[model samples]
Target: MSEIIRRDPRREWIARNRLHPDHASVLAALGVNRGGAAVSEWLGPHGVVRKNPHAIGFIGPNDVKRIDRSGFQQGGQSAATTPVAQDSRRTVTIDQPAFLVAVVPDLTGGRLSAHDKDLLGLARRVADADADQPGAVVAILFGEHKGEGDGELKEQALGDAGIDRVVHLNDEFYAGFAPEARLAALSAVEREMMPRFWLLPDSPLGGADLGRRLALRLGERAATGVWQVEADNEASLGWRCTARGGAGSLDIQRPLPRVALALAECAEPVDETRHAAEQLTLAASIPTTLSRIEDLGQVAVDPAGVALAEAEFILSGGNGVKEWGAFHHAAKVLGATEGASRVAVDDGFMARDRQVGATGTWVTARVYMAVGISGAIQHLQGIQRCDKVVAINLDPGCDIIKRADLAVIGDSTQILAALVTMVEQQRGGQRDAA
Candidate 1:
């Protein structure tokens, strides 16, 4: 005869309600909230959980187990459940100083931003040179939630990129680009880690805004769009950046514990994948006053219309394009973000945000189509990272033509019109065939 089995009341209740029996019943039994401090306590000292008074729970070691679909054992001892040694626990203090800390904003699509990767590489180099002991490279990822699937991939990627520790502030408010919420979270981490140097990417929206705000709040000097950062001695750091539209370069020196904003394409990413970094989660209380600006929704744009620094393909214009409307149409047809030289912005043909040059936004597109741009030195600096440059200019001797991978000597208006027609006809043909 088969042995009789008794059903667990909590498990039965969870089943009747169509809930996950193991996960729900275990949490209910332990009186633990999904991502709350109670869960951390139940998991023991190895698990670090921050209490966010305003927002929901955060990403932590427990999240990794949950993502792996590995049910919790009654008395099973694993990394998630193992308690830290008393001696080791004493050494890991909240206020200990780290060599460098890189604040990485959670990017969309659960991938690390190119600029953030570069910042990490820079941090690794700085830490190696400037530290008294073997310094640590820490990365703080502020986002809404631990991404889907086993959160191992992201953690591993950061480790491979040379991050010794990753502090994730996973809250719904952090999921989107909430500057105020991120600032609060970062402030909390800063207080806890007390890092000597802070690195931030100089992206238009997130990094620059956060870096400036943090500097103002903390009363630290901030250097924006910095190309190089090096320790002047052990106490001061030096920053190098372009000044006056590539006409000159400025080098500024500031004391330690300063915030530095890294410019795009300043450093190459290092390829050193190591074991996954140690992970921590911070729970923070976002001020209601600060979070008054709620994000409504996002509007859809063509996939190619990404940020200038992040775009793979770009259609840029100069004064040579007679009609701005035709130029825009050509960009739309090519599925490219519209960019402009300084002269075009000066002529009011393009907005300041669309301008690409040394003084404006620096772009590293895979294919850059420059229509009628004469290509000044400043303009050339912006597209230096572009893989292929296609220039259409009436003058064969123009600076842009000389530098272009493929140069077409023609009228800008005629070339743009022809390209638009060609793209539209191709689309029409594909539709008919379909």
Candidate 2:
């Protein structure tokens, strides 16, 4: 004979109602404790519903435990227990400073570059060393702030980067590659403000040239290729610095100089403090100097011809790519430097120089686009410094999709062709309008 299963409506109701007095007993009788799993909610001994937070969420594939506050795991949970997030940075305003730690950032493309932010962080360290009489971090900016359209937002970015004061030189004379005029402006700054520590990012984008020229003009020995700085009582400037010398093969330790050109990632970018980036004006007019070098403006260069390490935009392909010509054409249309995975290089589809990974050259491109690439650990490490990553692949589960800011799951050839057509149409429209 078949087992006769009779359902008690009242007992079923009690089992479903977690807040009921006999809910636990009813669930036990039905041989089900919240559907055979101890998750989020259960009836307590005294009829109170108890929540087990640990059992609510599972660990992700990345080995990190994630708590789903959306109630999908537990069914209709409230977020009332969640704590409010608050800003951790302290707001500081330095009205009267003992001295100024001047920073001349590269400010490539009218905005503060990563190298520039790192230099500011170093300057903040120097300025804040003496707690009793703190020195202000003064940034001398050349040309106009062009990246952010809103003026206040641009100034706020500088303030957030720990700049106490800003000296903006937007004169046409200071624009482009007028080293003589720029040197004269620095000379004027030297005579007037007389900053204690002059810091600059030792980058190819104008900072290195200006910093060396400033040191020479001021007749002070500048520490070039500085990567580390620490406080020392015995030092003349109350600090010591370790700099790379002999073409980055030797480490030279010496007393910190008044002028120092620091390498990228020398110090972490400032994020814990908001400063008053007050605008400063020169007391006296900057003296006019004869420019021996004339500004001819920038010459056109092929995107593919650019070195991988210096290229601002990169389009990389991998073994999954079938149409190499389409990939190259997309890169050309998008004005991106061509890069390739190690497998592609091994397969003779790409050059050894075009390979991107830990074994290959490390790139700091503003935008990195990977097509048909299942990202390896080495390749991901190489593009770690990239600002944005775009990935196109047939497999949605590929490792490249995880790291990409934007991922498109489609055929690489089709996507590249579509992108090329869109860019060409846009260019044609622009030309017609012009």
Candidate 3:
């Protein structure tokens, strides 16, 4: 019988490595057929591969031992037997030029707003693109300081959101949404840091007014409802925003020194991770020329409630709702904040603060129960961010019925009454079980 000869797969691999030691692993990993083309040509589409193979070689004694024991047959082959060189190393540095600053206003109840955190994340991305050094994400917090503990807590929260620095302007003048006072404080900061870009949330509070006023004061371009911001080139920055009338988006590129007002719910909030941030307390000198406006206390109403923008669950009323007392009662029973359509607010059926529509407050609620609402386009826009919309109206052909997740066709008062009873019964049952 003739002697049978078999080839070892490991030995074949070792032979290929000896022939093309640098590119053998890369060709195998990328599944590229190695013919006459050089390894540089093969890795063109992928990032540049340095000629020094030792830079990409395995490290440590354990790694070297593992590679040596992998059946890599090394005979008298000098090419494969040569050890990887360790001296030839390259260091790369990225150069960033400008700072991305996020201006966070104090929300009601002294708590940080969700939109503020989202703006911080967006600012971080912009800073990373434009800044070459560490401590690029800067936060400018304007609010009244309750105490040392509160100030420390707010600073810590900003640090947790990846803020590189916190400039807290805690003054009695910044207690309310006074435009002139805010403008003065912001102008001081602008003069000191001279940031490359400024980001402010497009809210009814100080955000919208302060952004525009500050931009005008600083003689920089201002863009509102800016959803996206990025570096256009090494010398310019680009801001993406929706055009008026909902036509399309517009990309506006400008050189350094610009301010952008971010729309509500535009960017998603990132996970909270603690980071070290330098905190600075600024001494704001309110300009003597800046006139102070007297703040009249808020007028008391029949059913005092949370702001429409901050409400979690809203029970909205429209022209179809006849009994205002019954509507308020139902909302109270269900633990829902009261909201009003334009017609209801105009007709004096509901408070102006409770209005929900394009001209009114935009509500982002977990559950929006529309009682007799017609679901006009303006109303739809206000509640567009609602997780679930439940509409109660008599007309089946109304827009609310078509767009609602759950539509009930009946008398608004009767449906609201029934819902209130059901919720109370569920609560009662839970209480009894507990």
Q: Per-residue CA lDDT of candidate 3, range 1-434, in tens? A: 76764444453444345366644664555544333233322223223332423322234444452123333443221112233454342221222435546565444345456677677777766665534453366667776433226657756655666667677766776666577777777777777777767888877755877788888998877777666554554555453444122333554434434677776565666454454457765565546445557766566443345667978788999999999999989988877889999999999988788899898999988789999999999999999988679999999999988879999999998888888899999999999999
Candidate structures ordered by lDDT, highest first? 2, 1, 3
Q: What does candidate 1's lDDT look like per residue over 182-261, in tens digits? A: 77777777876677678888777868788888888778867666776544545545423331223236554444346777
RMSD to truth, every model: 20.1, 11.2, 17.1
Query: What is the lDDT of every predicted structure here?
Result: 0.68, 0.87, 0.67
Colliding pairs, model 1: 144-175, 160-273
Worst 10 residues of 3 by lDDT: 74-83
| TM-score-sorted candidate list, best first | 2, 3, 1
Q: Per-residue lDDT for 65-148 in model 2, tens only?
A: 667776445333232233346778999999999999999988887889888999999999999988999999999999987545
Clashes of each: 2, 0, 2
- TM-score quality measure for candidate 1: 0.46
- 419 in model 1: Cα distance from truth in Å? 24
On lDDT, the leading prediction is 2
After superposing candidate 3, which stretches have Cα over 4 Å from the reference?
1-102, 106-108, 130-132, 144-154, 234-257, 283-289, 302-434
For all predicted structures, in order, the TM-scores are 0.46, 0.74, 0.47
Clashing pairs in 2: none
